[model samples]
Target: MASRCIVLLVAVLLSSLLVVSSSASSSPCTFPAIFNFGDSNSDTGGMAAAFATVSEPNGETFFGEPAGRYCDGRLVIDFIAQTVGLPFLSAYLDSVGTNFSHGANFATAGSTIRRQNTTFFQTGYSPFSLDAQSWQFAQFKSRSQLAYKKGVSYKDQLPPEEYFSQALYTFDIGQNDLTSGYVSNMTTEEVKQTIPDILNKFTDVIKSVYGLGGRYFWIHNTGPFGCLPYVLDRYPLRAPEVDSVGCGAPFNEVAQLFNAELNETVAQLREAFPRAVFTYVDVYTVKYSLISHAEKNGKTHQC
Candidate 1:
C-alpha cells in the first residue's frame, strides 16, 4: 500500500502537469494552487475550527501540534501538493493568519454533500455542507478581488485566470451521506434511491466551481465503509453479510454501487465539459487493497 500510494502520488503529479501542459503552450505545467472540498478524508482544519474535540493526538504524529487534519500524518492531498511542489493547503475556516495563495480546503469532518434540508436522514446539522463550502469559496473569490482592487499585498490577491482557472480542484465526499443514512436506519434500497439526487447536487457543485474558472478536477470516490473500524465494530456482519476476507459484503456492495454511479457521472461531465480534465480516482479500490493485505501494508489494525 505504501508503494501504491507513492506511485499514485507520482501519477497525480504527472497527470496534473499533463493536463495543464496540454491546455497551454507558453505556461509551465506546474499547478499554481489547489482547492479541495470533502469531508474528514481530506479535511485539514475545518473540523478543528468547528469542533473543539479534534485536538492534540490527532496531529501529534507529524505536525507535533493540532493541525486539524484527521490523520496522524499527511493525507493524500498533502502528498499530491508536495509531489507537485505546492504548499500544504489551509482550511478556509481557519482564516486567521492562513495563506490561500496555494488554495484552501473547504472540507469538514462531518460535512455532507446534501444540504441540511435536503438530506434523507435527520443527521446533525453542520455549516460546512457542500452548498455552504461553495459559498465559502465564492467569498474567498470576493475577498481576493477586493484585495486586488485595494492594491493589497500580492500574496493576498487571487488572480482569476492564473490561479483558480488553472489550479487543481479536488473532491472526496459522499461517504458520510450514505453512512449517516444507514446509521439512521434507512434501508439499503432507500439509500440507493437517493444516489441520483446526491450526484445531482454534486454535479451542481462542480458546475459552480467550473463557472468560477476551474478547468481541472480530481474527484475521489468514497472508500469501503464496511472495512472501517467503526463500521465493523458497530454493525456485526452475519455469515452471509461477511466476505471471505471478513469485510462486510452489504456495505461494500453499497459503496461499489455508489462508485459505479460516480464513474458514470464523471463520464457525463467529461462529455458536458469537453475542454476540462476530469479524473475519477478509485480510492475505494486502493483502500480496500490495504484492508485485504493489511500485514503486507503494515496496517495491523483498522481505523
Candidate 2:
C-alpha cells in the first residue's frame, strides 16, 4: 500500500510541474521546509489541537499510535514531506512538543475556502477558513523568525529566515467548501453560485502568501466527495441523479465545476504573479477515477 501511494503521489507530483514547465524534469531539488494549508485530506491535526484529539483507530493501523492525523496513518501531506526529505509538519495549532524548523501545517479537519456562518458545533464546519489559515501562516512566519533570532537553542525548533521564501507552500482545501454549502441545505445551483466568491477568496489568500515571500505553490483540487456515503445519505438522490457507478451525480457535477473554476484561478494567479511557481494538481481526476473503479466492485473508497 505504501509503495502504491508513493507511485501515485510521485505521478501527481511530476504531473503538477507539467503545467509550469514544458516537460517534467528528473533532476531533484530540495526544499528546506514545507508549509501546508488544507482540510482533512492533508490535515496533520489542527482540528484535534484546537478542539479534541482524535482517538484510537485513527492512527492505530499504520502509525502504531494516534499521530494527530485524521486518518489511520499519515496523510498525503506526510508522504509529500517524506518525498521531499523533510520531517512531518507539526500542526500550527498543536503547541505541545511541536517542531517548526522543518515546516507547519495549517489545515484543520473541517476547513473550507469560505467561512461558514454556522459554528463547528452546529454544522462541523471549521471556523479556520482558508483566509484564517493564511493569517495564521503570516503570524507564524513573523513570530518564528523572532524566535529563531533569540539564540542557537531556539533555532533548532524554529525555521530560518531564508526558509520562508524557499519552502514549498501546499494547499489541499476547497472540498469542504463545496460540502459545507450542501450541508447547509443549499440547492445545486446555489452551491454553484458560491464558486466565484470562493475562488476569489482563494486567490486573495494566495496573494497574501506571495506577499510574505512564498514563491513555490502546490495546490490540490478537491476530490470526489459524491462517492462518499456521508454525502449520499444526506443528499438523497433521485433515480436519474445516480451515476453509472451509483455515486451522486449532481454532487460530482458541482465538484467538477469547482475544479474547473479553480484551474482558471490558478492560471490567473500565474499571470498575476509572474515570479511565483504554481503547480495545480488535478486531484479530482485521480480520486474520481479511483472511486469509480472501486465502486464497480462491491467496495467504496474514501480519500
Candidate 3:
C-alpha cells in the first residue's frame, strides 16, 4: 500500500513536469531548483534529525540504513528530483552534509498547517508547521541574498533570483490537520469548517513564495485517509458506513470535501497570479483507484 501510494504520486508529478517541459521547450532541470513543503508523506530526513525514534527498518528497503524517511524506500519527492536531473533534496533540519544547492526539504513529520496553542492527541506544538516552514524559507532566501552579495560563486552559495524565481514550489500537506481534527472528536461538519482556515494558511504560503519570486507551483491535495492502515485499524466502520472498496465512507467524504475546496483554491490562485503556474494534482482519485485494484497493482495488503 505504501509503495503504491508513493509510486502514484511520483507518476503524477513526473507527468506534470513532462507536460510543462514539452510545452516550454525545457529540459529535466527546467527550473533552477525545487522547494518542497509537506509532512511525513514527503519528509526526507527532518524527523530523524529532530527525533531519535526514526531508525532501522524506516529506510532499510532502499538505503539499507535509516535515512529519516518514513517509508522503507525513497519518497515520491526523491523520484521527482531524480526525474528532474537533480540530487535528492537534503532536509533543512539536517545539519551535517546538508546540501541546499538543488533546494531543500522543509517538511517535518507531524507538521500541521496551523500552529496550535493546545495539545492535540498529546502532541505538543510543532516547530515546523506550515507557518514555521514559510518563515524558514524566508530566512533561506535572506541568507541566499546575503551570500550572493558577498561575491560567492553559485556552487558555493544559493543565488536568490536564479533559485527562487525559477524554482518549482511543491506542497503535499493537510493530512495531519484532518487527522488531528478527527482524533479530537470533531464532527464532520466541524472538520469541514476548518478547511477554509487551513486553506487560508496554504494561500499565505503560496503568496509568500510568490513574493520570493516563485512562479511554478505544484499542490497535492489530501489522499484517501479512510483507506490507510492506521485509520482502517483504528476506526472500523459498520457495514453501511463502509464503501464498496471497504474504506470508511464518512472519512473518505471528508477527504473529498477538502480536495474539492483545494481545487477551487488553486483556480483562484491562478487568477490572482496570472504569470504563475499552479497545478493541482488529484491525488485522492489516483490513490483510491490503486486501492480499488490492489491485486492488479501487486498490492496484497488490505490498506
Each model's RMSD to truth, in Å? 4.4, 3.9, 3.1
| Candidate 1 lDDT tens digits, 1-303 | 001122233334444644554465565557889999988777878867765546656666667877777656667777777766888888888856688878888987778888655432234435578988998998888778777777876645354436888888889888877876776677788888888999999999999999888898989888888766667777787798889778888888888999999999999999999989898888788677766776676632122
How many clashes in each candidate? 0, 0, 0
- Cα lDDT tens digits, model 2, 3-38, are 112124434454445334424545466689999998
**Between candidates 1 and 3, which one is better according to TM-score?**
3
Q: Which candidate is the best by lDDT?
A: 2
Candidate 2 lDDT at 226 equals 81
lDDT of each: 0.75, 0.80, 0.77
**TM-scores for all candidates?**
0.87, 0.90, 0.90
**Model 1 spans with C-alpha error above 4 angstroms:** 1-29, 117-125, 153-161, 300-303
Which residue window of length 10 is worst by lDDT in model 2? 1-10
True lDDT of residue 144, candidate 3 = 74
lDDT of 1 at 300: 28
Model 1, global lDDT: 0.75
- Residue 10 error, candidate 1, Å: 11
